[model samples]
Target: MHLSEQEPSSWPQWLSVYHKRALLGGGLLLATALLWPTPQLTTGQRIALPLDLSSTSTHFSVPDTLEALADKPAFSTTITTGDTLSKLFERAGVDQQTMYKVLEADLNILALDTLQPGNEISFYLDENHQLMRLEIDFSLARQVVFTQVDGSYDVEEIQKKGQWQPKAVSGDIYGSFYTSASKAGLTAGQIQRIETILKEKINFARDLQAGASFSVALSEQYIEGVASGDSQLLAIHINNRGKQIDAYQFSDGQYYDANGESLVRAFLRTPLAKTYRLTSNYNGKRRHPVTGRIAPHNGTDFSTPIGTQVIAPGDGVVTLVTDHRYAGKYIVIDHGNQYVTRYLHLSKTMVRKGQRVTRGQPIALTGNTGRTTGPHLHYEFHINGRPVNAMTAKIPMASRLNKAELKRFKSMVSQRNIQMGV
Candidate 1:
């Protein structure tokens, strides 16, 4: 209809209608937004969630392990010069109080007071640096253990079981007996015993030739499948320039020949039981070491370590025990047959004058007490008050074993000889 000309009066009515339509359209738009579909999550999609720390219900705690706290480390050390047990313990981080406690726990700990070089000791410490265990090697076969038990120390002595294994070694002398014997795996103690067994029969320094040979059968000690340093010589044979000298260990712990004769002679060549070098011979005219003047050196000198045991050459009475200007601390033994043996430069005299001593008995200790430049033993032999060379002079032999003892010794010798393949 052509309302433009007639709608002036009806304008309010038309405006009201238009307002009602606008309201209806706004309501429809609101409903459409409410009913619309949203996007959905896929099956493999991941979503990072935020932590909710506001809850007071959750808690965590760590569990303790007692085994870990009980473990400890062990320390081992060898005793050296001037090293004491207290110092050694300190080096292992142990306190003096604890060491003293352990030491006072038992009387066996007294052995540690006599410690020497080359001894070994071990320590075990806990996490708190407290000494838990201590082990000391008293010898190759003996050990002592101090353990912490119930907050106190307890001591125990353990003796190791050792096996004795027989060993045979043979060698020929090229330059010196010591050199050749060492090359054949002979220990120093073994070599010394060998020399002593043959001392009465052969002069090692003079009688040993280039081709002189020796054989020894010994028993070596083994502990826990390891070789220990203890040994015993069972038999020895020396062949010097086609002369054979055999010695066997009898039940009496002394060496005897195959004919049941004692290997110990009437007089020992030197006062020392161990092997040593001859520093000076019995010379009528020679230059003295300390004085540097020509003099009659009436005695033979043996170079040895200080404090080595000086043994009696024969059974005799001690006639003189005095110190001299040239001879330091000297001892003179007088045998009944116009024979006398003198030992000079002694560190200590173990015997007093008028005391009777048997052959091979310790009479003194070697030292540098006299007018000498070094540590040695000056030994002199006199026959009817006349000085003679002890090394080359004729020396008598001790009486052989009695008939019954000889018979038993012969049987033992036969068995040992078969074992030694002699």
Candidate 2:
């Protein structure tokens, strides 16, 4: 052993150092395997690793997803029941001051009293934080609706019309005429005629019984596919317990009792039935009653009590309504191109020029307002403006009924009468 104790050879010393390094490397590899985890989150939601950790920070690529989230849209509101303009603005999150500005911009826009339910309104903000469109629906009468567009409020009117569809309605009258007519699909025009026809015979509100029944043929008018009012009545049959009636619309304006004759007369027998006298008869050319001079006395003079109605002489158009020293209030009518008539000495003129006057239409009231000693109606008739006696002037009879038309008319009449139980 003493023989070489030779300086612990340098080669052996180097080999010993290399073995120690190999052992340290093996320990580090084992530690790393237990420390790191695979990436689980997307790029947009990536997490940062601590400096003490072996792995670097990583992320997933997700630009498309983030962009979609930022592009979501906003919405506004529409009008609903029991809502007012103030309430509507509040729901849209618009300020009161802004609403005032919008209203000021358009004077014809929505008003407080005209708002209607179920109308749409929109809201949005512009880049400058200002509102753009403001609108209110004004298409319908007595209604208002507001809307917004392009960051402003705009209003448009919605027109609602009653649908005009043919229908058959029948019901019993328990109370008033309106109640009964409403059940029968009868419109205002038809209801008016029904009252006119029955007013002389019965008082609907007082006389209608629970058993009284009515059948109506009529149409209804609708706006925006919504029924609003009733149209004209085509035909009607009313059964009032024992009283029965069938009426048809005639060209003369109202329904008839199976006959074409008008229910209204061309004239009343006298202006006042209680106290009236024929002061002067109609004459083409005669001595004037007041002046006692030869002149054209073209009208009949009826001395009547004050306030007596001076009715129309016939169906005509009012051509003149005037007041003169001699005729305080007077009306002239053109029956046609050939026939004309006049009424004079009135306290009040009930008609105007260019008005259509029906037979028995009240043109004025009697009074001693004109050149007269008493209240009277100075009536006159003329053919082509030449004065004639009104009392003796005979109206041409209506044209004869067409044979074919008459036959059809009679058939309809018979069927209606049977239905009416007449």
Candidate 3:
């Protein structure tokens, strides 16, 4: 109880003893930890836990492994105007022997006979640059394939499944209809079709003005989720100088206006698909080039190359197929209602007398067989036995559809109207 007065030395001794004992205990604990082995846990004895995948993102990729595995080189090209299959094969580095073999292998493969522009042709060549496989796209939905088999070639026709995708385009004309339509992504073929449908109603070359608007509804072909670059025009609406023209393609494959009137005319302005220069006009009392005498130049003259296809301007019965000293080889088509068309100086005549011909049918070939000084086509349009300027004359249109067809056409094209936003 009174140890506070005499515990100074005893306190020092107690503190020293306690410090040594604590140090000894710590060293012993460390030694035990280092010497003892940790217990190993098995899969069955481990605790189950949930994985956290919320913060992770998964991705997928498709590699073109087949293309990588192919040893030969593949070349593809589009057919252009005046392109031949042999020329294409040469361009693809195929040898002449291989080309001849492919050609002689299949006589029924006439796809190369009519080489349409824009068709695709592909070639696969081996290490020796010999053609091993060839693929020709006849159309968007059809292809012909030729593969080397047993030192020969085997041909196979493949039909592709395609879907129709509705497409719509609209634009306003600032200059020419061609320029504006091209800017709106319409091809020349499509523009020509539209012109054919509306030529009777609107003179595109003369009547189109600034601010005139147009809308076109068509279908684009899609195969395997890829567009095949082929399109079909379905419906069109044109507002030209406050006049509205609507044309819809019917199930019968003819274009009809909103009132069910056929857009095809009885006569086409030009007989040839290719445009030509007006060498001479329909004139009376003109000095003849050969005779140097005043003669009546009754027909219009178009200067074109020899063998140019001449088409029937209208549906009519062939009245005369004869050769004269003055007119040379000529054809006379007698359209009813006191109308007649004459094509003079042809190299070949395809239609015979008394044969029925439709408009746009090829009837003859242009030539220099007549008494003319140069190669040209002499076209004459007669009305009631008198020659009139076909380029400036007002040609009559074909008869319109009856009331029942009009109703049905309107009903069938009602959805097209909605799609065109009419």
Best by TM-score: 3
Higher lDDT: candidate 1 or 2?
1
- The order of the candidates by TM-score, greatest first, is 3, 1, 2
92-202: candidate 2 lDDT, tens digit per residue: 344666675455322222143334464434333321223333334333322333333433333433344545676666777777868667666566545755665545456
lDDT of each: 0.68, 0.52, 0.69
TM-score of every candidate relative to the true structure: 0.46, 0.33, 0.47
Looking at model 3, residue 414 earns an lDDT score of 88
Write model 3 residue lDDT over 288-358, tens digit each, in one string: 78756554677889999989999998877787887644576888886644567889888999999878677
Model 1 residue 22 CA deviation (Å) reads: 84
lDDT: worst 10-residue window of model 1: 40-49
> Looking at candidate 3, what is the lDDT of residue 267?
80
Compared with the true structure, the alpha-carbon lDDT of candidate 3 equals 0.69
Evaluate candidate 2 by giving its C-alpha RMSD to the native, one decimal.
32.2
Report the Cα lDDT for residue 190, model 1. Answer: 72
On lDDT, who's better, 1 or 3? Answer: 3
lDDT of 2: 0.52
Q: By how many angstroms RMSD does model 1 differ from the true structure?
A: 34.4
Clashes of each: 0, 33, 0
List the pairs of residues colliding in candidate 3. Answer: none
In TM-score terms, candidate 1 sits at 0.46
